[model samples]
Target: MNIVVVSDHAGFTLKEDIKTFLESENHNVIDCGTYSKESCDYPDYANAAALAILDGKAERGIFICGTGIGISIAANRHKGIRAALCSDIYSVRLSRQHNNANVLAMGANIVAIPLAKEMIKEWLKEEFEGGRHERRICKLDID
Candidate 1:
């Protein structure tokens, strides 16, 4: 699975950690930066990740920010990008299973490295149950 990881200053460290974890799991990763902890724009990173997925350069995305709110909002603005800001295992699972979310958003302040890894593991392994959920998923794309 090819995944794109994106983050701003606040989420830079955790985004690197998550990238390492994803790579070690044998998945190809595309790092769309804020390479340092210096302040940067979250929407820029979010746009890069969403475009990567839309362009077929990546199949999924993992985005991080201070509160996960701004980044998720930016990603969700793009049509066909269902970015889910989740802090729990259940939310992570359901994001993929029910929402068919291709983008998983996490908060750097809300979730630690360990918890983020656990959530990502659950998210990556869960298959989307696309029956009734497929109808709802289709309605998400207004463009």
Candidate 2:
């Protein structure tokens, strides 16, 4: 799977770690910026990652920031992107299984590295259960 990841200063280390982990799992990863610990805008990276996913350049995206909320909000502004801010395994699984979320967002300060890894693993492994949930997702796009 091809995945795009982006982060700001607060999520720099976590993003690097996640990228390495994903690559080790044999997934192609595109690391989109704050390459350094220097401060940068989260929306820039969020938009870039979301566009990549929308354009079919990536299968999914993972975004991280201080609290995850801001970047997730930015990513979801795009019409076809369903970005979910999740910190646990259950929410991660449900986000993909039910919501068909194409992007996952996490908080560097709120979740530990190991927990984040677990959540990502669960999220990637679960397939979207689209039967009953399809109607709700359709409603989301209709607006």
Candidate 3:
């Protein structure tokens, strides 16, 4: 899978770690960055990663911020980007299976690296159950 990841200063370390893990799992990862622990806007990175998905450069995205709230808000501003701020396995799986979420957002301060990886693995394994779910997802696409 081609995944685009982005983060602000607060989420830099977690983002880098996740990137390395993703690469090891044979995913083509794109790092849309703040580069270091330098202060930067989360919205900027969020928009860039969202565009990568819209442009077909990536299949999905994983965006991070201090609390995951701001970046998730910014990401969902894009018409087709279903960005889900998930911290648990069940919600993560449901986000993909029922909502067909294209982006997964996590808080750097809220979740640990190992657990986050586990969540990502589960998220990757789930497929969207498209029936009533597809209809609901379509309703969500309207501005």
* Prediction 2 TM-score vs. true: 0.97
1-143 per-residue lDDT for model 2 (tens digits): 99999999999999999999999999999988879999999999999899999999999999999999999999989999999999888899899999999999999999999999899899899999999999899888656
lDDT of 3: 0.95
| Candidate 1 weakest lDDT stretch, 10 residues | 134-143
lDDT of 1 by residue, 63-118 (tens): 99999999999999999899999999999999999999999999999999999999
Give, for candidate 2, the lowest lDDT window spanning 10 residues: 134-143
Model 2: lDDT to the true structure: 0.93
Candidate 3 backbone collisions, by pair = none
Model 3 lDDT per residue over 1-143, tens place: 99999999999999999999999999999988879999998999999999999999999999999999999999999999999999999999999999999999999999899999999999888999999999999898785
Of the two candidates 2 and 3, the one with more favorable lDDT, higher being better, is 3
> Which segments of model 1 are wrong by more than 4 Å?
none
Error of 3 at 98 (Å): 0.5
Backbone N/Cα/C clashes per model: 0, 0, 0
lDDT per prediction?
Answer: 0.96, 0.93, 0.95
* Superposed Cα deviation of residue 114, candidate 2 (Å): 0.5
